[model samples]
Target: MSRLLSLSFFVLGALAQGTSPSYDYIIAGAGPAGIIVAERLAEAGVSVLLLERGNASTYASGGRSLVPWNITLTQYDVPGVRHYIKNSFADKSEYCTDTPGNAGCILGGGTMVNQLAYIPPQNVDFDDKWPVGWKWTDVASAAERVHSLNPGSTNPSADGVHYDQTSYNAFANFFSAQGYTSVDAISEPNSKHDVYSHAPYNVKNGLVAGPVMTYLPMAQAMSNFKLQLHTKVIRAVRNGSTVTGVEVEVDGQRQIISLNNGGRVILASGVFSTPRILFNSGIGPNEQLQIVAGSKATTNVTLPASSDWINLPVGQGIKDHIIVTLNFNTTESVDFLDTSYFIKPSSNITDPYSHGNGILTQGYQRFTFWTSNTTSDGSVRYFQGTCYASGQNYVSMKLYLTHGLTSSGALGITAAGNTVYTVDPYLNTAEDKYAIASFIDNLLVQTRKADSTLIYSGPSTDTGASLSKVYTGGSHWVATAKMGTDDGRVNNGTSVVDLNLKVYGTDNLFVVDASMHPDLPTGNLQATVQVAAEAAAVKILALPKQQSLSSSSSSSSSATSSISTSSSSTSQLSSVSTTSSTSAQLSSSASSTLVTLTTSASTSSTSSSTSSTSSTNTAQATNPTCPKSDGTTFTAKSGAVFLVECYVDRVGHDIAYVDVPTNRIADCVNKCDALPGCVDISMSGTACYMKGVVGEKIVNSKYIRGARRIS
Candidate 1:
């Protein structure tokens, strides 16, 4: 069939009745990550199939959840509509019913249903938990690609205005009084410690612009790309360790879609659904496989024989951010937005909604802040807080225990073919409970100290046990199929996927979504999922394609990719050019001007703690001829190619400092190259500082920073 006709069939949901179409790549789940992988692979001149269990969400994607007055826009188009959809519109169709927890089942997945917040992951998010080759330095450029493709705005109004600032104004003042530094978070992603910033929403021209609005259209425009909606992938069609295709259910009819020779299959069905797929495919733990094997009533589909089962820890290590809500009475006259505006668009041209410049353009949360607490065990755990106006005099703060938490849960598939949480991932550990309780207690004390007028009349004094009972998950689920150096098939190994994101003991069967995230990120997970998909695409494309399997292999040993060369494996994917520049570090025309303001609060009594800031004044380069602030590639005299940025100094992870007496930039690069663990360098005057990892980046014109590019 012609490409156009084929695409039309797929787009119109004209189910392929009996026959299976061959494709070079078949991706399960059309979430932000799935669509991104589909687009990237299609762009590489490969035939791709992207399957979505849910239908289109955005109006542009044929969504019809429109407000009465607006025929051109759907409910998903508006940013603030997220507040209403979760319990209303989303429950009927957008939310996954098969999973016990909340998860988006629409075309864009979480990005389509979420609050549209576009907070990117901090460097420590990857540096701390991710395995080698998936670190901040390796995936930084991939993150930048996602950021460039989907630009965000703190103020999303078409008129370049912040529509509802009452809540933001009040909270910004409150956080400032608590000694939190004000920052444009997108510009300074590393400023997670004791910092507050305007909430960044991913929208364009007053409409939701996520993977559905950005990458999906690009994929649809390509002849090689086909999107099949209303198609639920049951499981991978596994032949020994090789995944030949996927068995899916369309309109209650089961079908097996085969892959082309040497093709690949990627599971992006999300944290819960992906593991379910693995379990159904006989690739999970023995206990889960046994349940599936005997579940003739729940799962009608025939399962692979017990002898072919590949035991791996697919549903282990599930994690979600624990959220604690605190209500405060503010003296500031904060007006609670009329949520009716979301369901009914104003017909009057004079109204801001007509111009897409009203409160409807903003998300529920006006401002977001980050804080950290050192637990009694001497380990630091980070927490993120978002403030939103709950009522005229009432403001609600949601405190999320984000990265560095040591709590985990398990996921399991029931005999009834439903995915359920085997264990809750809340404050399961005493350390996590203590950390959250202490953090809240400290925050309450600070709030009282900062503004005595702010009345707290919500929950009573929260002890660790009480807080644990009251806390709900942030719904940022991740790490079901974790990526790590250790193979899950091996004894004492904890990872389901390897560094290349390929599932252990399976050839050409990979996971590219939150299911593979080793840990939860610092903020919302959509942006991080897209970045990971981008990085995974680059790695998957660079690897040599596997030949068609003629006969199934008898060996049940772990399947390892040839992508890694050594223990570090940073430069192993040399076939794919890797750059060090990150989305957080990009200086773009669309970049918002950072308005950093110092609060009037005295810091004399504040704790001398570690923050995500760099002291650039003490590390200034005295040489007057320092390179300009333009992002340029510089080659060292010793033949090391580095991506150099002037006026940029990396934060933390200082290896050592060497004095380049000649005060030359080349000398600094050479010095960094000579160091054993140096991956980047920051030079000021004659002092060259070598860094093992690129942490948070602070703007400083006095120094030149170079991140070695792996070509």
Candidate 2:
């Protein structure tokens, strides 16, 4: 068969397929991190496929509002209703199982169900837990971008007033009187040592707006961007250390999702699922793989041989804030509301959205972060407190022992493929125990001095045994797939990924979520996780492009030549001279004939030549019916068809396009094929353009024509 006919068959085969659709990048989750990275890459004109285990959040889709606000909203959009998504309606399919705490399985991941605390991590959080290249200074720019895009408002009501300031004012007074600096938490994000501030949330106009409202909309607007919901990624399909694609089950039907040439896969499936996916793919410690390998269900598909497994400590380094709650009665001056109001949204709920002076806009009215006395290791221990109305006329203070805790834990998979923390993170060390106890005692003393009218109703002494019973993971879990320079596969290192967030043994696989954190930060992790993803996108874009199998020298170049000929009809001249070996030459007389050329190690030259054929012969060989290109006539490939538009004057008509410095008609076609939704291409001088949409098709010779395969 002729090369033109072969090219035609390739196009038809691609369009006829229903199961496999390739993309340049495949992201496994649609959380804040995943959505941010996807948007950035898609903005840069790379095709992306984002898969989410849950459907779109009700907030974006406009679900029913229990309270009549004259505006459409869902539980996800309201700050007061946020707790209902996880606490009241949690057992619904949107939540994950086998984890000690709840993790959202929806499109926004944890952001969909989290309390929306938008505090950025302190500088010490990065400098202490992150790798060398991931220090605060290195990530400052990304941090700034995240904060700028989603700066949660302390007072989100339309009205300029704060809702129930009774609890907040009391705590502020107490903390301030105790010598702790009072500042805007978000404004002084780095100063978490001894500060009390009103809690900052991603809520805007009384709505829980986050990445779902920002990055996702931009990505969804791009033609080359696609999202598949309710798809569960089981494992990655790999050959040796290179991942070709992922195996996912959509609606109970299993399918293989392939990647385009030189493509990448980013795992942003949270701290638990990210590691579990790696383990299922046989990319974890040997002991864990052995457990997975023994399960028929897990090993039902292709399993890597023992020696072929990438043995990194994937499930190690698990950490979470240790939380302990204390209840206290507020003075007569302070008023409170109970959780019942959240269930039955009162008529006053609209106050925040309409006037910005209601209780619905805030989670916990006040929050505090402070340090305890230095520990034996010379590290300053940290603690966080948030005071909110727990019930009628009663306030609850949830204290989180955040920083300088040396206790680490482990996550393991069950026979059913559920991720669970085999070793919980708690006060495992004597120093950690002492820190928690002393910290609680000091807080009690301060509260007694600051507000003698208040009455305490919790444990007086922090007996290690009593505290252990009450202490649990703060639900701010992190560090399952740690990132560091140390290779976990050797030298007793425990890190799973490198500083670049790439899996230790793979080239194209990366972890861009909380799973890559070396340790937990001192504040809510949502902001830091987002900043890390932004930084990861920058690093991934800077890395050298991965070479595709077709780009190899061993592949036949005849198809490429045929595609090039159909798009640009230069002369069928003899061999072109080069710095190295010369490419095979075509006979001058072989005008309409198909020819095969052998691979050559030659540097491209900028020389041109034409065949000495008669005008009639030239016209016959190079069909004038084809799109005009620089006075050169070209023949359309037999099976390939394009919608040609000429004299088009519109600029920036395409949603996204790739620019090649040195134009090659064949290279441009290949690039378009690799990108999803690529419909047209144009070449002008040395500039080659790949466009998503073509506005007009005029009959001007100045424009080169291209078309998307429809058959």
Candidate 3:
């Protein structure tokens, strides 16, 4: 039977008699992606178990860190006091203890405790290095789905007012005079070059809003879905390449929750925790696997044998955006909001909180701007500056070297199973140092030009080691389990997961969180992370159930011994369909939900173009056969033409590849044009290899090459 049909039956059976302890999809971590993916899968009429290591956060989730003045709401529900939850001193309940760096462990994870800055990703963020199906054009609709629900507000107060104009005016004048266009940053996401705007946050009418508010509630209402809080997933139980289930810790007792016939396990536990889980499951570099085996505190738990270890670079290339702040004494009069606001709102703020409209609703930072610089080596480095009231008559701009930074660090698991950053991804490289110093020098020049009264309060020299030492981490970790076409199980391969978000060399094991991102995005990660999850769900749902469950039956043989014998009574079915026995049952529900719940915007289709050249290319593909082994020329929508070569393979300089549908030649041309630095493409059947520098070309009949006709 098909996996979908089997899972549907399991759900119906469980609802009637409560027979199986297995689930169709077991998602680890209750972050934005985890919630979104679980909701979509459950809406498809399949059983899903969403697990979170931490307890409830935010009042909706049972978090009761109530605001001192108002007894009804918690600090997590308030937009202004987001910093309170982030600081360990104020509240460490949401903090992840296993990871050395800061990470949220609560329900909704980072989304629940974040600054709520909802900066939409720039188009170049996807078009630059992401794989084909994840390109800007492909995922634009998915991003729109998130934006439509969480349309970030510039004026968050219910009264529709920019409460504090003192800091906004000071910085706005500085940036506007420097020729930076003042825009709604969230609306014009691509305007990252020279723009200044009021900080846009994922807030609505003075309340914090995110996936917890939007996606999680829909999932909670579904009968096929069950959210298990405080259930910590220790590691995946796998029989060689097939993952059967995850061994979770509930109330200090280890238990295995097996997958149904075709169930899948998706790890969305951020960058650090995802890698740690993989390592514990013996699915990482030999050194890490050895550490996991050697570090076990108890012999009761059985781990995957050494011979079955999947040696991949799981914790390599971990990244975080390095932040550097500059304190300036501005002549403009502005006072910082006092910390006492957390205990009791000031007389000026009390009226606004009562009316749900005031200065208290605004984010700590008021104005934000973005800039970029091209180094001598021709690499562009991106920078973002956020201005906030630091003190009386003082403002601090926290400058972030957001995108295009070459430096990266590593994450590793210690003998005690603690995850820590082995190397800090800061200005460790000379190139990064030069880029940061150059950006600061240029920024100082601009500050002087924009406002003579804006005086630098820090070091006289803001260029070298002195400046670099003052940098803090942005805490936006990503790429610990990097995603790409290259399978990491092979020698010298760097990718941990494939284009489908499935972990390489493993069946039914995937990652759908920040860990799957190949690199850091251009802005705050929440918006982009949510969009990627939506796109990933679409791709995962398109796959056949049998293909996903190829080794499910055989893997069960090894799973029985380590699997939990006790069945969990924690899940409660609400409104599951009792007679969902056909495979079409899942698809029918999934299609309707994808259109309405997941994808709010109309899907972008490529067949609408009227280019005669594309029509000619498609005419050749009418036979349903692969294109000619060799070719001559083609044209893209950008009016750029390409010279095609047959039987040639790209040796290096591979940015990413596109899996084209009908017109392989025409689709390759369009994909190359969409990618930023794609100079050439090597087409191999359905796969079109997009190249950045076009290093070395060799003859291989399995593929054809297309080099752009650079005028």
State the C-alpha lDDT per candidate. 0.70, 0.63, 0.69
Residue-wise C-alpha lDDT for candidate 1, range 1-711, written one tens digit per residue:
121222243354334322336777899999989988887676554667889999777655767675444454567876767778756553368889889688888888888767777888899999998978888987875665576556577877777888677888888877777788888877788888999988888776566777776566555544556788888999999888888899999899988899887889999999889998999999888998888888977678566777888888887889999899887888778878666755554444215654556666777889899988787788779989888888987788889999999999899989888888888777888899888888777667755554554557555555445655688888899999999988888886889988878888887899999999998888888889989998888778666756742111111111221110001111111111112223212112221111111111111222332122222211223222223222445555455566655546666587776655444555676677777777787653234678888667743322234444332
TM-score per candidate, chains pooled: 0.75, 0.73, 0.74
| Per-candidate count of clashing residue pairs (backbone under 3 Å) | 1, 6, 1
Model 3 alpha-carbon drift over 4 Å, by segment? 1-20, 86-90, 298-301, 446-451, 547-711
* Leading candidate by lDDT: 1
Which pairs in model 3 have colliding backbones?
A: 647-700
lDDT of 3: 0.69
Instruction: Give per-residue lDDT, candidate 3, residue 523.
Output: 82
State the lDDT of candidate 3 residue by residue for 341-436, as single tens digits: 654566666555545677766777799899888877788888888788878878888888888887888888888788877777777878778888
Instruction: Give the distance in Å from residue 333's predicted Cα in candidate 3 to where it truly belongs.
Output: 1.0
Better by TM-score, candidate 3 or 2: 3
Off by over 4 Å in 2: 1-20, 61-71, 298-301, 351-357, 447-451, 459-465, 549-711
